[model samples]
Target: MKKIIAYNMLMVALFTPICCAQDIARIVEDVGKSVVVVIGFNVDSTANKLGSGCFINNKGVILTNAHVIDSCLSLQIELTDTIIEVAANSNGLFCTTRKTIKIYLTKCS
Candidate 1:
């Protein structure tokens, strides 16, 4: 009886971590849609660049400094999740020879 009690107590200790992990998994799974992954490409590295755009309604916009996305023909916006999807591709905008791309989010739209 004494050994059985000790063994049961050990099992309870192991069970505690599993319960906590389940709680964390549930929270992340429920709120994953609110997160995003931002990716960009720029050919010119010497100058500072960025862009700013609206992301409300049916639009998924990318705004950055003037030098950030210069010469980038496209920008990719994806959801941060297991089945990550590239939700949008921005049409390129240029100032001088530098181009910045603006993509519309498909999934979010």
Candidate 2:
């Protein structure tokens, strides 16, 4: 009886990580709709940088790395779900004017 209990515990411990990974993956899938690909453009309408960001609210607010938009004259944010459905690269999205957008840093103090 002791050996059987130990064997069962070992199996449970070994499978715990796999189960946790699945749960994490499911969470990501659900949250992926709120994720976007942030693209920066120069004054000449050329690509400057690319990075990922997450929308914090339904008002189109995005949080991303500072370097992602460095030296950029314009920005474009494409929803991951839309990108997946379009099957196109970052160029598929339209650029948004700077006046109509806002970005915030999420760094820990």
Q: Which has the greatest lDDT?
A: 2
**Per-residue accuracy of model 2 over 19-75 as CA lDDT, tens digit each:** 999999999998987788877777688877899988788655567787776666566
Segments of candidate 1 deviating more than 4 angstroms = 1-8, 41-75, 80-109
Query: For residues 3-101, could you state the per-residue lDDT of candidate 1 as single tens digits?
Result: 999999999999999999999999987656444444444444222323333334323343344443445544444444322222123445421211332
lDDT of 2 at 63: 72
Question: Which window of ten consecutive residues has the lowest lDDT sum in model 2?
Answer: 84-93
Worst 10 residues of 1 by lDDT: 94-103
